[model samples]
Target: MKFTEGMWRLREGIRIDWMNNVERLRVENENVELLLNKFQRHRGDTLNSATVTASVTSPLEGIIGVKLVHWAGQVDNGPHYQLASSSGHTKINHEKTETLSYDSGALNLAINTAPNELDFVFSGAKGKLTGHSWRSIGYVGDQTTEKSQWDDGIFFERQGYMLAALDLGVGEKLYGLGERFGPLVKNGQTVDIWNEDGGTSSELAYKNIPFYVSSKGYGVFVNHPGKVSFELQSERTTRVNISVPGEELEYFIIYGETLKEVISRYTALTGRPSLVPSWSYNLWLTTSFTTNYDEQTVTGFLDGFRDRDIPLGVFHFDSFWMKSYQWCDFEFDEELFPDAGGYLKRLRERDLKISVWINPYVGQASPLFQEGKKNGYFIKRTDGSVWQWDLWQAGMAVVDFTNPDACTWFSNHMQRLMDLGVDTFKTDFAERIPYKNIQYHDGSDPARMHNYYTLLFNKVVYEAMISRYGKSNSLLFARSSCPGGQVYPVHWGGDCESTYEAMAESLRGGLSLMLSGYIFWASDIGGFEGTPPPALYKRWVQFGLLSSHSRLHGSSSFRVPWIYGEDCSDVLRDCVKRKILLTPYLLAEALAGYNEGTPVMRPMFLEFPEDLNTYPLDTQYMFGSNLLVAPVFTDEGTVTFYVPHTPEDSQGKWVSWFDHSKTYEPGQWYTETHGFDTLPILIRPGSVTPINPKLKAPQDDALNGLEVLVNGSLANDMAVQVVNPSKTHNVLKVIKIESQSGNVTADDAGVKVVRIGH
Candidate 1:
């Protein structure tokens, strides 16, 4: 993806034609077009050279999209990212021979048209954000010449690439390239936007989205489905170089007054995260992969949680549910689960939901594989044979979701499971798709479908679930995703090792994904690769239960809490109870995420955009708009976290949720040691959190025993929306609380009020 060796020279076998001057400019309504050619000195300079055609338009109110094309004759196949657009919101101005500007809301794109100088400058309400200047836009050719047997038969094959570089301002930090695990700040990093199955320890990511939010109150989304490479301050040190191997490169510049508003607009263009069911917020226990488990083993795990007085929500059956070597058969192993339907019915009677594991692969041993091969329902090679690989399963063939009949065939199998009382599915492993010498049934470009395969795979299964269950109850614990995949709720960080470092990385990945327009995210509670030590398990349990979704899963060992120690179970029970009490507040945040694209688990900068101290702090995050959660990473239970100062807080203070008497001033850092039962959960000033202490499960009515917990003094009366747990986006009531004489009282006489700090 790197084309230059340094500033002065290009790499071998590379030729780049940078856009130097605009030869002609045309405006049609709100759309602008430009014909850019190389530096023009005279009429002789215009012969036999490459030129780039640029088109600019506004997709949304505050977004401007630019497409640079090197060649307009190449055919563009299918597999494009879905974008929402609106018209009649743009204003265009053309000043004679000097400058041309296009305005979308408060964001403006200005082109400098003075004779040999062509530059594109983007400005917002807060002055210039970023722009293209110097050697910023170019078309590159990578070629190799070969000689044939005859001396005259010499030929060259060249791969064309279009690139655009945008200016990076001083101290501007970038984030959210899709669940990255390296660092929260994306400066000095070369990121390749390709989906892979690599674990949490590598730069390779399972979810690679080509959208990034900047610290400068703006964001850029590269509108490509295929591989888009980004050199973030690594190549030029002051530019974000974006290159794609094709005829054209399209990107959108989104601007807002704040970072949260920028993300809101980005998600509006891509897709908004769907609201997941409330019970999914509770604890989920899974049968660990490769562990010896049958119906009896699953029963014992359930019994263990019940005997220890721990509340459970969903019980998941991992890959072993089906026979070995037959993954997508969708039938229970007769040797292990003789009466699968009866067992699921009994679990349903006990008020538990059932989730089973599945992938978009049909192994050769599965009966459906032969059916699919005969019907041409799988991805095929040029010879019209199914593409097979022996990586995860024997002779595994990827199901072609592009074919309508193939999608129906796959969904019918899922429907059979739904008839047996399965409530949801853990859609896993669509990242390892083949892109070379393969063809989709719908004739989509293979390279483009490589990352887009997960979207189709999850959509098929998610729609199946919605058909069986209503939209309010449909959910998927998906593993891989792309740009518009947020419409299918609930994805998790995949395949982490059982260690404190991996636990911290999982948190970093989840926080990064939330910033990418995903609302609900989880990780393997105690990690997934190896058995976790008791200390690590207890710490991870606390962190996992606080997330939007919680699950306990591992690779070789069972994730049952009592397997570690009695203390682990006690700590997990307390965390689960606390989460159940916090469900009323969490549901409100989920509604915001669904309605406005505001993430439930937010980075600190998203909440306090004006506070410079909050920009670099990824170790902690705002649980919603109010509570700050700093997970204890070390076994010693020592953590240092920061509290930010805001104008909303009169006293500029934060109160600890654990010890209500303990308070800390804002704009300072504090280090504290906690036991296994506690970490730092601080409530921001002037916030009221609704709690239901008597609720046993998240499915229970949250309004039954709701109590408003006021954190600090309220300058004015605040209204809190109490959400109904069973329905989506349904508000049961809004409780109005009046703050008088350092004490708060609710308007509803039946609701109890609890005050934390005065």
Candidate 2:
């Protein structure tokens, strides 16, 4: 998607038309209409003239919207949020000097137009916001379907586009591109906001978002469902360049006082995340991909864990639940599962939820393929043929989510599965969608369909559960996503290699994605690509158990704890018990995450935004607002993490939960080595983090034995809540921590604050 020749000149066969002049300005009430062009077109050129009509208006005091329309007949079935805060009435007035400005509540949207330049500056009662300036808007094109060895004429099409990128400040760092597994700081990276299945070790991502936030306290969201390219200090080193193929590009500039507010407002615009079931936060065990297993085999594994006294939550049945080449038939292989519903019921009777793997694929051998083709429920090529691909399955066709009938048909299949006690669907393989020579019922652009397809797929399945089990009980173990995909809860890192390097890479990716505003994260506990040594599995289990969501899955092998030997079960039990004990604290964190779009498993910068070292540190992350979790990525248990100096939490009271004998400081780095049992976990100063020493994840009685640890003499009160994932805060123990008055408690809630220098 890079159109530059060595970052200097435009490539060959490329044509760019930057808006040089605003030829005419017509004002109608609060709306201003302007005609933008490259040059004047004569009568002979009128038919092929490339001109754009931009409509601009101020909907609120600090908000401006520009809707660029090329084809008026297109439907805008908008999935946008209704503005909660609508400001003053807008007024547009034109001056004699050819400058048209809209005035509203001391905020002015001035359109300074002349022969070769245009500028829209927004300054208001509160502050100054971002806008466009000289040569900022452009329409560019490249010979697409004309000549390309990459794809056939049926695939690539001649494409024209609009592009823009705003300037970056001296110390500004960019964040959030939807669960990226790269550097936490997005600078020096060339990202395509296109979802793909490139795994954790590559530049490609499964969840790509066209929106990104900055350390300077603003967010930019590209309003495109297509593959939008971002050059974050990669092309120019001082700007975030955004480009999308089409006639026009529009982006929103969101402003807020803090980074968290920016995310809350942004999610408010796109969609709020579905509140996941409290049990969904517990560790999930699965039958790995391409592994052979049956009821006896699965029961043996479950019994093995039970014998070891390790708690098991939801169990997942991966692919191969169906016969080979019959994927998405929505029927369990009767050979393996003679009584599917009865067996699932038995499993659920043991107090476990059930999840199964499914994708939107219709293989040739599947009975539903012909039915879909006959009913036009599958995506079709230009020649009236079903778009068939042999990548994952032999002659598999994708369900056209743009087709309402197809969505209904797909949902019916899911309902059948849910009727059999399948609590959730592992909605996987959405990244490899077709983007060319395809027709949609809604006539949506195919390029846009590539990323938007996942949104539709997850939505359809999520809604199916809502109809059947209700909204509060719905969830998905999705592997791919887009900007709006955050509306679905839990997404995992796909197909990582079984190595320490890949483990670290997974953490980096999770942290990167967390900064992009995803709340829940999970990964293959013992690795997926190869068999790991006992050390690796044990280490990975500890890290995975600490995540907001955890899963044990693999490829070509079973990821059961005993597969690595009985010692691995001990590791699982240890970590799972601790995670259960930490539930009271984690649940409160999840609730706080709802109001502010912070991830339950967070990047270090989110908790310590001022520390420059924290900006690039991705190896470690915060479990919530309090505990710092540094997962041991190596076979050796060496650990390193940063502590920020906060006015509320000073150095003296920082305590290690594992060893109360050891203490740390603020604004410094700590290195320690331990046995296979522990990783680095620290409590910040003046932190009133709660804990429940039990092996249960969800409970209504949170007032029992609430243990609150006060880190230091904090100047402010740290409110303590021992509640579940429903976001209802219960003050089991509320105390005021101060350097002046000391720790004052309202009740005997087993709260303790070891005074620093005591």
Candidate 3:
């Protein structure tokens, strides 16, 4: 994807034709088109050779979309991100001359019809936001001429690449390249927007969304579902370069004064994340992968949580549910689970939801594989053979989600499981889709369908759940996703090591996911590959329980608290209870994510945009808009974090939710030591935090006996919405607690209001 060598020369066989001048400009209906000619001297020189036709239009109120085309006609097979709403012919006010100016909302785009440049400057109510200059547009041609063709002039096969580079201002940082695990600030990094099954330890991401938000209060989303290679300050050092493999590349520029508004607009174009069921927020216990487990194993895991006094919500059955070498057979292993339905029924009677594992693959040993191959339900190769690979399963053939019959065939299998008391499916491994020399049944481009496959795969399963169990109860524990895949409720971080570093990286990945518009995210509590040490296990328990969704899963070892130590059980119990108590606040945040595209686990910059220090602080995040959670990553149970002091921040003192004696001032770094039972969860000043003591399940009706704990000084009116116990409705509760000279006066609606600090 890198085209240049160092700062000067092109690498190997790379050729770049930078559009330098615009020959003609005109407006047709809702689009503005420009006929761009490469460096030309005389009028006759612009007659032939390759030229770029650039079209500019407004897709949303404050979003401007630009598409650059090199070839006139090219077959576009299908697969594009689905936009939630249409722009519907937005009014464009233009002033024509040698230099034409067009304005949409507060976004002003100036086109130099004579020179080769397109500039976008946005001025909102908060003044100048961000701009993309013309020097960033590029049409690259990569070709290698044979030695014989050099003299004969016969070789002309050149791969077309369209690249768009936007200006990166001083001190500007980029975030959200779809659940990245490295540093949060995406500067000096070359990111390829291609989905892969790489674990959370590397630069390769399972969910590579073609979208990013800048600290300068704007976002750019590439419309291409295929690979989008981005050079974030790595290629040009001052500009973020985006390259797509086609003659035409389309992208949208969204404007907002704050990162939250940028996310709102971005999610509005793509879809907003749907609300997950309330019970999903509770603790989930899973049968560890590759571990010997059956009905007795599952029963023991559930009973272990209950015996340890841990509040359990959902129980997940990993890949071993089906017979080996026959994934997607959708049948319980007769040797292990003889009575799958009866066992699941008994678990449901205990008020615990059941989730089973599934993937869009049918191994050759599977009974359904021959049927799928004969019915043309699997992806086919160029030679018309069914695509088969032996990576995860023996001769596993991927389901062709592009085919309607194939989707129905797959969904019917999942629907049958749901009918047998299964509440959810942990849809996994859609990231390993084939793209080379493969064809989709519906004629979708293989490259585009690679990442978009998850969108369809999860959609089929999610809709099946919605059909079986209404919209309020539908959920999928999905793994891979793309731009619009946030519509599905829950996605967890993929395989991770059982170490403190992996735990921290998981948090980093989850935080990055929030920036990418994903609402609820989870990971293996003590990592996925190996069993975590006792210290790391206890620490991960606190962090995992605080996450939007919590699950205990591992590969070779059981994640039962007793496996780690007796102290781990106490830690798990304490963290689960604390998270359950904080359910009212967390559910309110989840509702906001569903309705307004605001992420429940937010990066610090989203809450305090003006504070420059918050840009690179990925170690900590705002759980909702008030509580700051900084997970301890070391064995000593120590953490170092910063509390930003900005005008928009709460105007009172910072209060530690743990020991009331341990309080800190804002705008400073704080290092604190915690025991296995304590984690640093700081509440912002002037915030009203709602809590539910004696918490049970997520559907427990705690609203009738809710406790509104006033954190710091409730200097302003605060409100929190708690979902009804029946999971039917969200009840909005408002409290006005004015901060007097030193005392606070509260207006309570029969709910206990307790102040946190003196």
Strongest candidate by TM-score: 1
For residue 5, give model 3's deviation from the true position in Å: 3.0
TM values, all candidates: 0.98, 0.89, 0.96
Ranking by TM-score: 1, 3, 2
What residue runs in model 1 are displaced by over 4 Å at the alpha carbon? Answer: 144-155, 739-747
lDDT of each: 0.91, 0.75, 0.82
Clashing pairs in 1: none
User: Lowest-lDDT window of 10 residues in candidate 2?
Assistant: 76-85
Candidate 2: misplaced stretches above 4 Å?
6-8, 20-34, 37-117, 120-134, 144-158, 650-653, 724-758
lDDT of 2: 0.75
lDDT of 1 by residue, 228-275 (tens): 999999899889999999889999999999888888999999988888
Model 3 alpha-carbon miss at residue 23, Å: 1.2
